[model samples]
Structure formats: structure tokens, C-alpha cells
Target: MAVGSVALAGTVSGGEFANPHLCQKGQQLLLYFRTIYGKQILAGYNVYPHTPDDYQQTGRHAAIWGRDIQWLGDVDEVIAHVQRHGYILTLHWHWFFGGDSAWTRERKTPVVLDQLLKPGTPEHDTLMRELSKTADVLEKLQQAGIVVLWRPLHEIDGGWFWWTDLQHPENTAELWRVMFRYFTEERKLNNLIWVYSAGVGDLKKKPPEWRRRFYPGDQYVDIAGIDIYGVDLQQDETPYWDYFRAMEEICPGKTLALCECDAIPNPDKMVAGKTPCWLYALPWWGCPHPRRSVDWARFTMGHPQVITLDELPLFDDASYAPELGILRPADDGGAWFPNSVPVIEGFVAGRGSPVDLLQFLVDDKVVAEIRHPPRDFSWTWPGDLHGTFELTARAYDAAGKQNLSNRIHIAVGVRNAARSRSVRASSGTNPEAAVDGSYYSGWHAAKDAEDAWIEVDLGSPVEISQVNLIWGWKIHPAKFAVEISRSAPDDSERSWETVSLLEDLPWQPWKATHRVRFAPRIARAVRVHAYQRAAHQTWAGYDLAEIEIPIPAR
Candidate 1:
């Protein structure tokens, strides 16, 4: 759903900028010169594997994704490239999916960690050792003053990463505890900010107890992130926006992030102002199509609600991309610029077939439409070009359920940079569960074509804690114990190992969920992989409500 057009903000591409400033939010993007794309390794123009046209390309890590990269250039070569770009050098465990879902060691050596995620094994040890090595790399980056915004173990709720084997919550916590100790305690490296992210999935519909099983708390993460990609209005984008609103409310005290994001497609659509549907119920806009084009730089430069590299890059002043005309004052939408009225029309949401998301800027009185006739509709400029407005669109299906839209934003006279907002906003609400301290219940629901969840955090290190589930009020609540696993903080850098099983206790009103706390072996986090383990049931299904752990609160 995320997509946006790139503006080679007129920086002398070859040479680095002489300034040393972290690109602050709301500032224009100063031209950035990087040879990598996302978190994967990329062979720069001076390195091997660089195509003849590498110089013409926008990013270096163009095609690579995942851990265990086979780089043609060594870390020194990477440093050299960074010197040339002279902005902030960026490296990431970019793609943590596919091919056994683990780190690949030797360049392109296809070593995965999927098998290692399972309970109890030597492979798990190997994973931990490898993580220590990765920490070494992070340490180096830290020394460079290159504030690395490393997001290693992201999207935990999705059963994709090594720490989330649904059957091993304790193991997950153990792994996090080990990672935290290795990085924060042993390594003594603190120049980096850690981000724990989840896909922009709804957590509201889920029961409170089920959401606590995978709660990696504020103690572990520096920034609580949610990966939000823009969506084409042609499809429902409620889920993405809902996450934004939820975070605004529940995580008011925590720093928020669109840790990973994509601009909704069609640079033209943004020309007008805001997306309409967002004014209403948030919906998932994952229609089948590639509306993802806008890069992170463009987005951070524009939106200030979320924290991004521009907010704090190693090199000062690296945050803003000034050349994109982002800092310039908007000239009343249509009347001000040469292309002011240019209509921006295309798929704002992913629809089965392409749908029109007609948009045009307004400066004075000029008008432009991005879509052609027949498909395009008409509208007029109402108030001040840069003034915010709640726009409504008209379209309907046979049922008149209304293929509708509504959004709020301002036009001309706004800041010159795309980031300079004509309006202001808050991060929004979290899940109902967070209201009480039930972690996931409030803001971390998994509502899609999948089974729901429950999770937890041991608070501080503790031994095999009792994972008590309140199955029912009756006979020995079927035996559904909470499982656990521990992983390296950078789960992608290593793997996971199963820890133990804490079984059921007396049923509580909060569904069949609760846990026992002891002066257990000290560890950091724990997760309960919900399961329907008791074979003999009339319904033959698993159901859990809430999860609790008795921790000596810090």
C-alpha cells in the first residue's frame, strides 16, 4: 500500500554535503547520498557487483533483503562509501524473512535459522554466538557517532521471526533477556536506538489476555514502532489508519514510529491535500497492487508525528532534504505554481481493478485534475489554500454501501517542504487492554484471516514462571500450559531456543489466562504461544482470554 515518487533533491549526487546536522522533522530533506536500499547489503559504485549504471541508481542495497549477506566489499569499503556520502551511514537487518527465516552468513551462503527457532538444540547456541558477533558490528557503528536506528527483531506478532514460534513464549523472553544483557550490559554500546515493530494489524478485536503473551515491554525497546505503509484509496485503508489512531491513544507516553513505511502510490494524489477515508473508520487497504513508491526520506521530511532518521541522524542537519522545495511556502494550491492545479489521479487504495483517486492542488482559484475525463470528478477551492479541510468524495456500489472517502489537510501557504504540514495531529489511541496494564490487549490485536493471540513479559529476569491459563471454572481446566522461548535481542542475527512450560491455575474472570511469578531465573521477556492442547474437548478448539505474570515490579 505504501508508495511515493522520488525527488532527487538536487544534491550534488557524487559529493557529500559539508554540513553536520540531523535532518529534523518538519525540515526539508537535504539531498541524501546513499548506496544502500532498505537494510540489505548493497555493492556501491566503487565496489564489486556494481553495475555499469550503478552510479545512476538511487540506492545501493537495491535487490538484497534478509540477514546473512554475502558482501563483495568489507566493512572498511562500507566505511569508505559512507565517507563519500558523508551523511549518516545506514545498515539494517533489512529483510528478516524467507529461506528458513534466519541469518545467512557467508555472502549469499543461504544459511537460515528457521530450524533453530524450535525448542532445545545446539543450533540455538550457534545463533547466540552469531548474535554476539553482530553486536560487534553495532558497536563499530556506535563509535562512528552514526546513530544507527537498528530495528532487528521487528514484527514479532506475525509468526515470521524466530522468537515467535507460537509454541514458545518463555523461550522468546529468555532470548530477549540474553540479547539485552549482551548489548546493553556486556557490550556497553548505547549509541543506537532499538525499535520493536509489528505489522499494522488491528489489536482491538482480540481479547486482553491473549494479547499479553508476547509483551516485550518499554524496558527493552527505545521506541515502540508500528510498520505503517500508505494505501491506495481504491481499497480499504482502515487497518493502517486505525493503527495510527490507536497508537495515538494507548502509547501517548511512549515515542511512536512508522519504523518502516511506504508512500501511497501516485505522487499526484498528495497534491490536493489528504486522503478522505481516514476521516472515518480505518480499514485494511491491502488491495493487490504495487502502490508503494514513496521512500522513507520523503515521508519523514513531511510527517512529524513519527520519529525517523531525519529527526536524529549521526551527521547533524542530515534530517532535512531542502531541495525538494519542501521548505518553500505553499502558494495557495492551484493559483500559486506552474503545476499548481495539476490533477493527481490514480489508485489511492488497492481495488480489484484500478480506481480513481482524483486530486488537485489549490492556490487562489486554479484547478487541476490528475485523472482524465469520465473517471474524473470536479470540485472547487473553498477557503484559504493552506487551510485544513475535511473533504468528502462521492461514489457508490449497488448496495450503496458507498465506495466513499473523507480526509483532512491544507493546501498552499504551507511550508515549502512536503513535510511542513498545514495541519497538526496527535498519535491517537491504543487498545482497550492497555488501559489496565494488560500490555497487548489495548493496542496489539491481530485481526485478519488468522488466529488471534495472547502474550506477556516477565518484567525483569525471572525463572521458569508459571504460565497459568484460566480454562474454565470446572474440572482440571484442560491442560493448556503457556510455552516460552528466548532469543537474541537481534533475533534475526541469531535464533531462538525453547525454555519451559508453565501450566494452568484457578480460572479467573479474565478468560482462561494468568501466570505465576517467582524469584525465577532472572530473564527479560516471555511470551505465551496460545494453543488448543487438551485433546478431549466437545468443541475441539482453543480459546484464551487474558494473561498475567507475577513479577516483582521494578
Candidate 2:
């Protein structure tokens, strides 16, 4: 059983978490973000259809969702369906002031702010009622062992919501503290991960530093985030970069996220702009203008650095087993060139018997063994390495039960065998481009071909273990097979043996590498056969940047 699988009623001790295991899981999730910050980004969205559309287009689900309070009643059902399936959850309330809609700019007033903060006032009573109601909903989740990323009074500096005290904006900070104290001390809702969101005002007028004026201090917040929209989606994203830096300055050491966005930031552009990667992104749903297209969704969701729903680990498992996670060499399929030694770091999580030992394995062979593992342990590759390797960590508890961490694949000291090799295609414009070793060039199949394929002749049978595919910018074929042929290089009707049948390929954006590893085989030729194009593509054929078969060191 998972953490939320069982529901418990009543209060937990000392305002502590109702489910300690679930809290550990939440910490693990935060560690995951911390490890990836400045390195990678997580793909997220808001509400239901966005989730489904993400899955439909990318063959993967968005990692997280910012759920609106408007649909508070269905939250439990939503949690059972999505959260149980590894989707991270956050709640955003568009509070109504005295029953008035949050959208009315006139609802934000100095008089209302004063009344809401002052006791014995009608507005203060209303504030208590609303906060208590929200607390009750959160308590339900706590009872069910679910940890929430709770975001309240978002866009406080935007002057569009009642929570925004435009006349005396400092009152907004006090308001956040009040809710923090109420929910944490009074209601004992310790399952929440508090998020303080700043509004991205007109950069030209207000500038990024304007956000610092409303911060409620670091102690009261867990994550520092911002909501940006209508910003230019260019390679040089100076505005967003400045905003993220400002957030870092204001809430130093806090994880940053795009809590609400009209456009998802591209990981490649973020890296190019020298901007720190966002922990996650939550874009609004179904907006007609600035709407995320299928291709755009595929690009963001499929990027190797972006974490999809399917990539989330099982944090709530209830088995009597220790949980292990890898913390270093973060990107699973990242390639480390020849002679680079990778430092492996990991931890054993949850409540159970202490881990007796930790064994770090490379390709199923134990390379380093720790007799008594600490809360976190480290191991270094003993020598310069070569070949494609699968790395994992196994933890053995005192009683001898063991658990394994998720596996990560990396290549070291390997050269692309398919480069400058003979190539052929059934129907494609530039089939040779796939082996040309150029990121910008690729082979594109003819639209009329029902079963499209491109083959690379290795000149003669050589020992090979893996293939790395760098896909074209806008086109991807989710279903394909990697086959090897031992027949003579000149043979037209070569007998092809399928080594790997991939039905759903991970969303790897343009020039991003997706590796397929298999047992070592002797083959003169290898080919990728495409059965179908991605469902949402208007392009009639498949396309990819390069197909590389890495030759392992002998």
C-alpha cells in the first residue's frame, strides 16, 4: 500500500504531519527538485483536460498540476486518480472577498485590508470563515496522507485580487503570515508545502526588484515562485531570467517555480539564457490566445531534462522496505565523454529498520559496497570507464530485506559507430543526414510511405550494445523498432532481427538524445522502422537528427 492508501481520522501530535511516511516522501520530492535546480525543469499544467492533452500529445503526463479552488469538491477524486499515479499537486485559491469575485479590481481596498486583519470586524469574521473552510479541505488530505503544495493569495502584487492591498502593500505580507500561523499552529495542517508567489508586473514599469517588497520572509515560505504571462518566448529571455534572479535574492536558497504561466519556458532556452532552471511549471488551461499547441507541448514534455508524470518515483509505498534514490548524475541518459569519472550519491528514505549496507552497481556488477550506509552515501567510479552502463543503488535493511533505486543509463568512452556510415531509406529526402553528425540536419521520410525506415550499414559485423537517437525539432515517431541485420552489407533483402520494439518513446525534444540499450550483438547493419507518426503531428512523415550506435571499449 502507498502512503495515502489508508485514511486516518483525528489530530496528529504537536502539529506534526498526520502521516510521517508521506512527509518523508514530500522531502524526497523536494530533494529531487533541489538536485535538478539550475540543471533541469519539470513540465506541469492546470486541471483535467490539460493533463489528458499532455498525455495524448507527448506519450507522457505532466509532472505537476496547479489545481484551482473553484473545484474544491472534486479534489479527493482527482487525488485518487492523478496523485496516486505520481502527479504532484498544488492548490491555488481565487478567493472571493465578502462573496465578491476576485477578478473585480475594485474589490482590493485599504479599508477591506484593515477590516480583514482587525478582529471583531465583519470582514475579519469572513476571512476566518474562509480560512477555516480551506483548512478543513486540507485536513481531509492530511488525513489521507497526501502532502499538498499549498499556494494562497497568489498574484498579491498584481492588484487584481482582494488579497492585494494596493494602498499599503506591506499589509499583504502580514496577511500571508496570519494564514500561515492559522493553518500551521491552530489547524495543525503540517502536510502543506507553503509557496509564496510574486506577480510578474510590467517589467518596463515596475522592474524585477519590485517583488522583494512583498515577501513574507523565508521562514514562512518553503518555495519562492512567480506567475508570468505575455512574456516574449525567445532564446534571450532576459525578463524571465531577471525575475528568477530577483526571486533568488529575495528568498535565497528557496526552490523557484513558474507557479502560473501562459507559456512554458523551454529548457534549452533557459540553459542558453544562463537562467537557473525552474523546479516546475504550471500553465493555465485552455486559453485561446497564447494557447499551448500539440507540437509545443510535445517539445516541452519530451525534453530529456523535463520530468514527466511517468518519471516520478513511488513516494508513498507502504511495503516494509527501505526507499532509495539516486542524487547525482541527475539526467539518466546524459553522456559523459571519455575519461570522466562520475560521483554517485544516494539516500535511503522512510521509517523502518536502518539500512545495513548500500551497494552501488554498474551494469549489475557491484562496484562499491558500504558496510553501514549513512542517511546519504557516496561512491566514485574507481577508474576511467567506457561503454553504455546502467547505474543503480541497492539498500539492505538490518533484517536482510532490500530495495533498489531507479536505474540511470550513461555512456562513457564510447564513439558513434553509425557516423559517416553507409545509409539507405525506403522513402526519405535526406536519409544520409541521420548519420551525418550534424545537429541541424536529419532524415525525413516521404509522407506516402506506410512503413518508413532508415538503415545504417556498419561496413562489417562489429560488437555494439546501444543506439542513441536525436530527434528532429518538430517531428517525432512515438512507435518504432530498432533492428539489427547480420546479413552482408550489400544484401538488399537482409534478414532483420528486431532487438528492441519501442511502442511509446519518451518525449525527447529536438537534438535531445534518447538511448536504446540492448545486449551486445554482431551486425553489419542496424535500422529503425517506424510504424506510425505521433498522433498530433500534421506532418505526414517521421524525422530525426542522428542515429548513433555507440561502440563499447573492448
Best by TM-score: 2
Which candidate number maximizes lDDT?
2
Local distance difference test, candidate 2: 0.69
The residue-by-residue lDDT of candidate 1 on 1-554, one tens digit each, is 21222223333321121112222210122222121111111111112221111111111111111122223236555544443333333233533333243433322334234445444666656666667777777666556544544456555555544455456554554555566666766777655445455555546553223333454554665444465555543344455446655554443334444444443222222232232111111111111113321232223223322122212222243212110011222111211222243222212221122333333333222243333223323354433333222232333222222232321123223221211111111121232232232211222323221222333433333444433332221112333334343542335653333444344433332123333333344344444343323333323223332233332222
lDDT of 1: 0.34
- Model 2: weakest 10-residue lDDT segment is 1-10
lDDT of 2 by residue, 437-534 (tens): 65446888886664788999998888887887867655677788899999876678879899998876655433344678899999888999888666
Give the residue spans of candidate 2 off by over 4 A: 1-22, 48-52, 106-111, 208-210, 286-290, 318-554
- Residue 334 miss distance in model 1 (angstroms): 22
